[model samples]
Target chain A: MADVPTKTARAEWGTRFGFLMAMIGAMVGAGNIWRFPYVMGNNGGGAFVLAFLVLLFLLAVPGLMAEVALGRYTNKGVIGAFRDVVGRGGMVGLGVVVLLVNIALMSYYSPVIAWTLYYAVHSLLFTFTQPGFEAEPFMLGLFDNAALMIGLHTVVMGSIAAILALGIRRGVERIVVYAVPALVIALAVMTIRGLTLDGASEGIAFAFTIDWAFLTYSDTWIAALGQALFSTGLGWGIALTVGSYLREYDDVPLGGGVFTAIGESSIGILAALAIFPIVFAVGIEPDAGAGLAFVSLVEVFPEIPLGGLVAILFFVGFFLATFTSGLLITEVSVTTLAEETRFTRTQTVLGVCGGIWLLGLPSAYSVDILDYLDFVFGNWGLPLATLMIIGIIGWVMGPERLRLLAVNQNAGIHVGRWWNPVIKYVIPTVMLFIMAYFAWENFGTAEMIGGMLVLVLFPIIGYALMSVIEGRGEQPDTADLTGGDD
Target chain B: MALTAEVIGMLAFTLLAFWGIATWSLVRTLRQEDRKVEILKHQDRMDTYSPESLAELREWIENNPNDPLADEARQQHNECVDALKHTDMHYYDWSSEEIDRLDRV
Candidate 1:
């Protein structure tokens, strides 16, 4: 392996505290708030939770730690880091896969963040508290208002761009340090309020009740695994990019990787605590799908005490979770561009944000496009990239070697030898099984076909365009591309 | 009724405890970092040692084999010599000043 240069100036996280908070902020997002509750409601609740915890510890934690180890060890963005780790050949292809995945995800994800922002402001203005506020029609109205959707989209993307342009310490770290704590506090308050509601125990019992029969269904296992993976931000290269700024001495095993997983999972449980009690107290159907947060919760709020204030708190919390996540998602592209090209950070941020804004128009204008993009990126692209990443770490690099060199080297708590078999065999086997199951179940639909085409074609086009750009000699200084000073 | 109150109390306590632990950990990390910086500052001046000074010290140690301070000089010279290799292995291009600045956190 060629030695990475030692003397290129790169930004580092201000402190371990800042790094941990930023990572926790990245993991605890809209998935924890809206998606986790409904998934638990639809699945077997306590049984699903058990399976999710099992998959998280066995598969997601190791995968997350591996990505973090790769980033910290290489001290470069995904492209340069992958190039260094995987060596010269196949770097561009793998790099494009990781890059395009993040870009495509952010293209759709920003519109959702815009939705939360609009709702947060709308709630604060007492709009939801108005007489006879119809939740479904109102939500549909907002979605169909093209001007408003695009405006909120611009606002969300612009805020992320402004924060990222401030650099790591002043921008990302400062916001997350406050944002994560605020999110938890808001959730705790809402949880207390929900639990205090008159008929809340039924919801809590339903959420925590165990039904072993559901474990027999493979669908339960797949949904649990999907939630665990997506909720923890595995295979997204967002963690990998965040880990790139980690100091050499920061611990990966316990303080960095495992801690982030625990924090994120705990927040998911807390979200269930906050949401289920209210839903049960109001006697709403728990399996409300994507509308569980906006429609169902909005319906429940009007019938309860302090419901207006609680609604404001919930939407505000949702906004914080989503906005912070959008920041990290966009940072992946911003950092890649800044490191790869001769462009200034400002130019890179604006260009990336502007491009995403234009690309996200379809998702903003139509719910069908939004759902389709989410299905393509979420189900197929994310899992495929994650499986490839795990394969690289396991079979290509040798799991034991990665553990020794990347993980245990600077870690505060070293993983046991059990990690070897888990990373090498168990995680990859489960991931392959999940991918096969998804393909078997969803492969025939028109949406699936369209998703598959986008999944196949987006990266090939991205890789080709990237190759052309690299060939045109727009590459930045090699010294800068490598970590450290020239 | 008592059990319901107990459950609520327990849940509230657990949440508060977690927040307390997070705050304590942050404080402890900052304090530990401060101690590390202080120790690094006083332990040795190797971070500031120049190449020419290192070479001169090595030669002095070699020539003054019987001198009283020769052992200490040799130790300092060896440390200075190893510093370059350590720098090469570092992940970030952190200069001594930047390191000091980081320590201020």
Candidate 2:
């Protein structure tokens, strides 16, 4: 591997607050607000929450920490960091996997951010709050309108590109420093308002009440684990890219990884508080599935006092969370290009965002495309990639060495030897089982095959071709084990 | 299990406490960062020397190698040079071929 630079000029978090906020902002996306509530509600509420917490601590946090450590220790993006950690050559394939997952995620995710932005504007305009409002038709019309979808998508992607072009501290940190606090306060206010509604308590009961029956079902555990992983942005290389910018003194174990996980998981609960009470108060179903936020909330908003304003605030918060998360995901791709290829940050942003915008066209045009991409990447691609990452860290790099070199090195809360076994054995085993179950359930579908071929196989082949084209050359000396001062 | 008055009260309290802690933590960290920013600004001034000034300092250190301030000035000059080199290195990008070659070693 190329030697670690004796000095680095990479951008860093300006403050601990900025770093933590960015991390939380990256983790607590619209998924936490929408997906988590319905999933928790569907999977026995408190029981699922319990499983999710356990998995977050046991599997997700360690995976996140390992990624962060890889990024910080190597001071490289996913591809470069992988090469640094596990020598070079074919490790490029692993990098490709990480890069492709983020890119694929961004393709579908950005459009959703656009949708949130659209809904936020729509709420402000009182489009849906008008008398004789029909939410289904309104949503259908919005989704079917390719021009509007693409316009909003362009706007969202363009804004992200603009922000990223300003560099890390000036752009990402500054935005998240304001956006995350705003998101939290908005959710808090919404929760307070929602709680004041009649019958709101029923929703809270539904959310927190445990149905022990779900504990017997393996699917519940798997779903909870998946939620935790996706919710915390594990296996996505975002944390890894974010970690690449960490100053030497930034704590990884406690403040960086653990605290972010805690903060993110709390947002899920907070979202449930903000959402469920309003849903029950308006007599809408808590397990309204994916439509809980978009449809159900739209239906209920007009019934409540000052619902129009509340709707605007909620969607604005949703947009901010998703936009920030999208920014981080896009950064992974941007950083890779800027570091690995002959692209400056500005050129990389243009190339990456333009590419994602084009790729997201089909998703913008059709719900099927979006769902297909989400199913493939979110369900299969992410889990598989995450498993591969942990396996690399645990087996290839030696979990104990990673612990000493990455986790415990400059961390305030030193990870113990227990981390080694948990990462090396327990996490991988759980991940493997989840992947297997998902594959078994999803394998025969045409969408699965097409997605695997397009998303998974195509990337691997492209990387192989690139590697061959590049050819092997003289190797640089091994990086100095002593990480240089920033 | 029902959402009684106490349950509602507990939920509200918990969320309030979470918001409180998050706000407090953010405020504390931002305050600490303000102080760090002041120190960093000063350090930025000390660390940054113009290339012409650095060249002169280098010449001065070479001429007065044994002078009391020679060691300190030389160290500062070297640090500035290193920082410039680091910045230049970051500005340039590596090709896939170069990255592969680096990985091989």
Candidate 3:
């Protein structure tokens, strides 16, 4: 209501394939390429995959269906979508909570993407295969060099800003359609290369051997749960933002929910195939974890056949993975801000990208700062955002209404009553449990305190801001839209 | 360590289940979109809801006449019914009898 501009016609994906690719491109980031492969290797491999797959279908699929359906139904960005559902009040601030979390996440995330970009460029230079290339010094050289990290972070954000400035179809879709498939091909080639290496079969055995006993471990399920949700980027307002641009008659459940979730995870499976064999082949620690493994795994690339080329493929593909996610994560803010305020898309893109780059400077300056922020936000902020999104759908907007109206309207598959409770009950419960678990695990720590701060403050800020804003005159009458079957 | 048959079998199943299902979903949804485009090109409008979904819409509208979104729901339900009745070919499975039986909710 405060000096809002007349709205422009919304953009739609130029093609269905573009939409699907965007979802996959956004979801399959460093998590899929780096973390997923090793997480699978360490977590009883086949048993973990089974549990992860089950959780993906059970939670991620339905949660995404609801989120995307809300977006398409309202045809608006996060806050605007919230305004439509919750009406004109401080309550609309709940959407603000989502926006804040997304921005915070993207801030630290830009620096990480910068790491991938640096590695990708190095890969192209055949740096990893250089006889004198020392993995620790190379990685440390990049991490410790504040100027280089900042420059890379600036480049990543600038690239993202430039891409997002082109709008959904021309900018986002155009890039993703190419970037996603390229990542797959790179991984596929690496997989084949890894397989032909001496002792590569040991890698497969390590990754594929079923430890059925893992199914009985609570830790295994927890690990699987995190992998499933994190890899899919569920409830991150990402699916919602992407879903907002869905063309009329686009099916939400099949494309947005099923394909997006599974397709992204497929890349993880491919990554497991791509990386594990090589790690085992060269005798690196399989459980070195994502960060250590990433640095340690680099030395192995040169030790293998076609090592230089494989290095290029892995890093460049890794760059694209993180780059695409940076694009969409930034888009969540651009899309929402463009609609909520008077800013044009280009203006919004610059403002958002500039803000993120500025905030990311600290993280880029120090690896420890980046890790600290990552731990705090990744554990808490993401789930809180998820809870807000799915909570609104389940409680306020009503999953039954959403399924009946938007989800099933052009759904490729029928979503029955079974989907309703999952959206309403199961997801919120899981989110609460995640937060509680993290809080307990990190008790008395700075990370836990930072998380606790985000949990408490973000909603209050959102609510207070909305209350003041909505108190202004000449707002849209959203009364009828507020309550549903729930 | 040599790859045992158990490891080999598990690898195959994981690939088929994850990559196979993903590939299948991708093909199916893209195909569905193509079919929707084809049908839309032939007619001014295509049916928005599948038969099963349309019926659910009808049932929901009937049950929640006073619901805030009921009017929109009814309108959507009827739009599908109209498209199914008017279009020569349909995207979702619909029998001749079913089309004949369909009316505005």
Candidate 4:
């Protein structure tokens, strides 16, 4: 007499626009504006971009479609969805990824948000004039004290948790409705202005110039694939968990891809606009692993016109992006706690937020610690998680069942029965190839080794805990946890 | 003091490198052990019933009503039969992709 868990809240989007905007909020974040262009420049600019786009089609979009299908059909978070598709093992694997990735991101991401708030307030207070005079003073104004930035980060994290506590369609969705469009317009304006500068052509050229030789390298391809998965927030289970809330009628896969595409492409383009002009103008070498976003950009900020104002605005945008993502991650943790502990939703939310805040203290205290954590969880944890998710959905659950769940909610475009077979056998094989390729190029390095540990550690720990909790009873038969009706 | 600091840093780096390799080996070993346990569980379950019991089991299954665990039981039954060499498990190989072939048959 095992009972099916009753659906608590039907995660309905207020409108199609709201859903799209929220997806955009989730997809577009710190990585896009900060990391994309610099990485592209260092990695051979247009050539890398082209390769990344190819990987998106061959890997990311299909992978995303699969995740969205799992969410919409099951109407459950990562843990629940995996249990339905594969088994208890799958659930533990996904839970590990989601928890670790969220923890790693929150560690360093909050500090950047604080910096944004600091600059935004400073801009309004007349610390930076529009005429670009007193540039040195503006640059000096920021980072003169680390204490102020840390305080701002704490405040921002609290606000983020509060927004999530308000639930998806009401608070988080509403903010994105306005914020995403504003972000896009701001990025476009900045790009145009950057191109018009005397040294702007050099920047644009630097971004657009293709190095054909680098295209053949396996490392380049791996990096591109990783970015595609990371940028869209896949495998980490945030997107899938959000997708679980949707009504059955929505075109979940299409919606996910559209958001991912826009988010990923905009990041690549916007980072170019912010960085290329300055880097080329200043004669700094563009190297992919040189930590372009924070270190490189801040060094050049003092030279730009109304630099403080721009800095503030840029940080605001950065914070908005990361804040939206942080909010969603917190929601996942809270919801999981509520379901597992039989705690009320409010109690779970409060407890989870407090816990994440406490865990994130080490990261907030030092850049080196934050960087190491990010390297461990963000880089390696996500890809490993994606690989396990693909295996569960594409192999264990049987492709036909997965495909049926995918097509049940909305059936406009017909992919036919071949879809499941491809997902089952073909997709996982491709992911394996990609993962192996990554390991060949990057494994054995200290950073990657730390990353592999973080990725594998929690799943083992989580499964051990579950064995303790539900070990002897006729365990929750993972096979019986099927996705919802079409 | 500076010389001492450099020596300490090198030693820490070496220790970290050693730890990484050890962890990787441990993960690989644990995964192998888990797979072994899963196989053993399946074997023990299969060993619980004989051919006569399986035939009677099949008859009982045919008569019994469908429930959430019905599909699993059937799959496990097939696995058992395959293990006992009573029959091949290819009967369940009919993927949805083979639906057209199934229809033709």
Highest-DockQ candidate = 3
Ranked by lDDT, top first: 3, 2, 1, 4
TM-score of chain B of 3: 0.94
Alpha-carbon runs more than 4 Å astray in model 1: A1-8, A462-486, B1-105
| Candidate 3: residue A70 Cα off by (Å) | 0.9
Worst 10 residues of 1 chain A by lDDT: A477-486
Better candidate by TM-score, 1 or 2: 2
TM-score ranking, best first: 3, 2, 1, 4
> Which CAPRI quality tier does the interface of model 1 achieve?
incorrect
* TM-score against native, each model: 0.81, 0.81, 0.97, 0.73
**Best candidate according to lDDT:** 3
Winner by TM-score: 3
- Kindly indicate the candidate among 1 and 4 with the higher DockQ: 1
Local accuracy of candidate 4 as per-residue lDDT tens digits, A228-320 = 767777666766766776653455545554335544455556656666776556565554422454445444555566555555556566667
* Clashing pairs for predicted structure model 3, backbone only: none
Q: Measured by TM-score, how close is model 2 to the native structure?
A: 0.81
For A15-73, candidate 1 gives per-residue lDDT tens digits of 77788888888888888988887777667766777788777778777888888887776
Candidate 3 local distance difference test against the native: 0.88
* Clashes (N, CA, C under 3 Å) per candidate: 6, 1, 0, 1
Q: Least accurate stretch of 10 residues (summed lDDT) in model 4 chain A?
A: A407-416
**What is the per-residue lDDT of model 4 for residues B51-92, given as tens digits with 9 covering 90 to 100?**
333443455346543644446446545654544343222212
DockQ, ranked from best to worst? 3, 2, 1, 4
Task: Give, for candidate 1 chain B, the lowest lDDT window spanning 10 residues.
Answer: B44-53
